[model samples]
Target: MRRPAAFLNLIFSRRSIRRFRPGKIDAEVLKIILEAAQSAPYYYQAFCFILLEKPEIKREINESCGGDFIEKAGASIVVCLDLNRISGLLDRLGIVHVLKADTYPVESVLGVFESGLAVMNLIMAAEVMGYGTLILDCALYECERISEILKLPHGVIPLVIVCIGEKDENPPPRPRWPLESLFHVDGYRMLSDEESERFLENMDKAYSVEGYLKKYAGWAGSYREYLANRALLTREVRRAYESISAFLRRSGFRP
Candidate 1:
């Protein structure tokens, strides 16, 4: 058994590595990591992991996602929610032609959540195996194209691509909001004006404290401005949403 302290150490030490050394992970180790990921809790195991190892596939994914990091990683796993699997199970149970238009969205949400848990488990497993990991939703921008390239089936919708490789950089942890500001006892309570002001002040202090913000100089910006600019809420993001909606319709998962 791992020492309690060591387990906690591993959790705290893991980071999202953007760069990686050119090396391949052993097949056995990769298998173990995947096994750990599959161990994640789920409602109905309605998800699948697509392991991408081919250089040509990785290159195409990188090109489509507008990044080289995915290609550089030793391996990438695309987490997909298998709506078809769920429907197949329903069919096997003799629930023929049940119109689940309203409930399908909830099922999709639960499937995505379960998939997220599995991906996180895999990330931790990779880190424990002494490999760096990075998760990206950039692939969602070209989800339809990537799915076609990967030859994904009708009901499997790709959520995120996780890259695994040897670490090439060490970086400090990003700032997080204080627990007091975020958590409320028993039932949730909205913060008052004064409390909100204090929270913001604490957040700024945390950002500048230990020179963390300085390390990310020019990379930092105001969230207010970011929201105002609506830069990330691009047509591509909207189209991606529309594509997913269409996929659901095509998969017969809609009302």
Candidate 2:
């Protein structure tokens, strides 16, 4: 078990810092943070992170993402995978090929999950090093235009972006589901209809305090809404996934 006090402190203390002080992060510090990201587990995939510091490139990216604030940070880190290498290995193993849209759907989801975990490591390390981080997936992957801006090869796609700098303010921790409702002694336990209703009702009430409309049912309603907000993205991501998968097959990675 972790020390609750220490863990709680970390949980409450960390916030997504958007405004960065104008200065360069020490080269050694950047190296350590990148190393922390590389330590994350990856399944049959290689991860590469790109650091963006050039003003011109940052400006172009900011324009592509439709958010000029992306250029404000000291630097932006983007995570990508070499899909061409992944596909070739899958071909040899006679496993599912990532080129097919059906086979690549779940694979893309898993790949994104891995990239997210890696970025999280960098964020945590930044906090410990007395820096702040705001991870935004859009800055690196707003649309197909971003790929052109990054000059990403057919098989390489930007998965996520993390902005690092010093925090200017403290952010309060939001409420979470109760611990009892969160854990089960053993096996899997799905939420009962009764519990589901109460769960969402309580959540709606909770967010009401913050002057938000509704929390929706459980978490899916809110998630679905968020997904819909970027509904047009489904096509771009699918195309990018196939592009990388084809590249991976050409490389050496298996399905």
Candidate 3:
């Protein structure tokens, strides 16, 4: 695949940024970036973007989700799925019962897909325009509280929060699995023990524990501890999953 040099550079140089300088993005630039996000391909689902530039709200979100970088960054954009809009349209068409009858695989799954597509578009656009962005999954853990904070409606579920601003730090790209490991020929193929071990060794060398700590020093914990901490990974993550599921059901997305 022969990609243009500009597109390849954008893809290759993009990185998840945590630290940011104190400066607001230009209004015109922000508008164009949001327009890029809106241009993403969605499968008939309406999405909403909430821009948060207020210092107090950013502080509240930082306290709630424990991602301090959010407050330090320039702004946060909350990407939400507008189920109410879809439901309203369906109701007007007199076919809202179709969703009520078969909701398992549609409402819950497709909304996420649409939001992810738009977010990626926004991220790439910001990166190309000399800005940094971070996708904050912590918002989902405190979904209800965040909903209240953002003043979101009952059917508008916050899918992901994106932090965008001027970059304060330049970091190297994170290590990824080798092409052979990620790209299986035609179908899925599980890696053997040796292959898996080799991959782990390569990653360990590419990104040592010291490197991880230095990069995310604000987290204030070892990488191993971060991974082993059940409070954040298991408990909070499970709660986030349940919250989204319950939100969908309560919003009449159940069969």
Candidate 4:
């Protein structure tokens, strides 16, 4: 399929940028980008964004977020949803159906997907305007604290935080798995032991444990420990999941 010129430009040039030049994205441009984000499709619910603009606030957020790069970001956006607005929007937009009297699927599997579509639009808009952007799932800092700072009411779960700015470096394209390895024609087909070796052959060695250890220590090791130690994944994970549940319940999204 032939993509329109601007669409192709968005797809090719959109890269997650951590490093950013110290500057500001203009107000008009930021508004346009937000409009683009809101225009994204909803599979089951509607989500809104909270745009973080003030430098002092961004600095505070940077401390909580654990990344120095965030302090220089031109802007940050927190994607969230008002449960009823989402529920109503989903029904109105045909994103959700009244499957039964007291049951709704929007609260479960579909919310993330809705957010994904909206964020893509956000990225596309930022990229087209010559701004580099990074989707910060881990750099959002404290969700509840941010809610308090932003003055967001109960029920808004900030799923993804995006930081945007002028880019500094041109990182080389990382290798991708071969077409055959990634694209399966149909069905779940199990690979033979020999076939698995062949699959790994075409894959870049940088993805391997030894290769990763050369650049950064303890990545694969930590993962290995995660496999061995149940505590590694549980300590930080349960609270977040519980928080999501709490937000959902408070916002009228069950589960």
Candidate 5:
């Protein structure tokens, strides 16, 4: 096998950093990161970034989104699925039929897909530039409140918040499922109950060694318990889902 490129190492070494040293990112460096995002391959170009640098704005977002680390980062960037720009262009070109009610679902999916590609590029660029970064999806939990705080207009929905800054702590990489379970050959491979249990055991042992349960969920004894405690069928999770759905509908991404 050919050796991996040096840049690929950056992807392997990247970790989600929560603690950051106090310092603002240089304007030139931030501009380069944004340029990298623009370089991502896209089918519809339906994405935009809202950069939050002010302490007050960051504090507001942190409160609304429930990511306490957001306020401490050098900058927090909201990566949004923005179909508004496309809708405007279509309007100018007299192509209104493309964005009719039936197409909203398809547009929403495509917008999120394209935005994810851009987000990966933005993150890798920042990592290669020696900045610690954290990706927070908590923004989705309170999307309506966040939209109000960010003053997002129609046809634009915040997907994730990327926080970048200097690293204050160095931690080992988090545990992940085995590659055999994740990667399949030509066709999908179904795992047996035994295989599933083995994978879970391995993950639980690894997380226990790292003290992940104590740090994140002290009440949970194992990683499996931690996951069970955060089950999605609960009332709070349902409310978050409802809020996200309402935001998507109001932003014209849902029918």
Candidate 6:
């Protein structure tokens, strides 16, 4: 096999950066990044990128979503699933019968999926240009507040906030499920009990080496325990779920 290209190496080296050095992204560079995002494949092109450089707006987003790192970044882009734009275009073209209520659910899913692909392109372009990126889903926890802050119209939902800036931290790459556990050839494979235990053991070892449990959840003895106690469906998580669900329905993304 041919050696992996530099772009593949860049993808492998990319990390979710939270701490960023103070600096402003040049307008031309940001334009290039956004153009790369627009090149992503799409089903309906139902997405919009709202670039936020104002400190006050970033601070408001931080307050709403509890992502203080957002204010510290050079800039943030809110990737919105904007079905409203598609609907407007359809109306302008007199395509009245296209977007019915039954199609809303499929369109919503496609919009979100396309938004993710565009976001990946944006992130990779930034990374290749020597900027760190952080994808924050915390916006989902306060979707209504984010909508208000961004002045989004109905059918426009903030799907993610991407923070871009120079890096200030160099944390180790986080662990993931083993390839055998995640990948399957031709069909899905159910993990055996022993395989599950091995995966957990590997994760525990990696997290232990990184002192992740000690720093984040001192009470938890292992990665498994930490996930169960702190990362699973806790009260705060349930509240976030409710908030996102309600906002999706109100924004016309759900039936």
Clashes of 4: 0
Write the residue-wise lDDT of candidate 2 on 1-255 in tens digits.
767796567757787775677777788999999888877787655456878877888888777655444677766877775564565667788876554443345565566677777887888888888898887766334534566777766555666677887666555444566666778887767777777667666665555564333322133344335435546567877887686556444433335
Q: Residue 53 of candidate 6: its Cα lDDT? A: 72
Measured by TM-score, the strongest candidate is: 5
How far residue 239's Cα lies from its native spot in candidate 2, in Å, is 13
* Cα lDDT of model 1 by residue, 139-202, tens digit: 5556787888998777777788999999998876755666776898899887788876666566
- What lDDT does model 2 reach? 0.66
Candidate 4 — worst ten consecutive residues by lDDT sum?
A: 209-218
lDDT of 1 at 201: 64
lDDT of 3: 0.77
Which residue runs of candidate 6 sit more than 4 Å off their true CA positions?
Answer: 102-104, 213-221, 230-240
Model 1 clashing-pair count: 0
The backbone clash count of each candidate, in order, is: 0, 16, 0, 0, 0, 0
Off by over 4 Å in 5: 102-104, 217-219
RMSD of 2: 6.4
TM-score-based ranking: 5, 6, 3, 1, 4, 2
User: How well does candidate 1 score on lDDT at residue 117?
Assistant: 93
Against the hidden true structure, what lDDT does model 4 obtain?
0.65
Q: Write one digit per residue (lDDT tens) for candidate 6, span 103-140.
A: 34788888889999999999999999999999988666
Best by lDDT: 6
Model 4 misses residue 220 by how many Å? 9.1
lDDT of each: 0.77, 0.66, 0.77, 0.65, 0.82, 0.85
TM-score of each: 0.82, 0.68, 0.85, 0.71, 0.93, 0.91
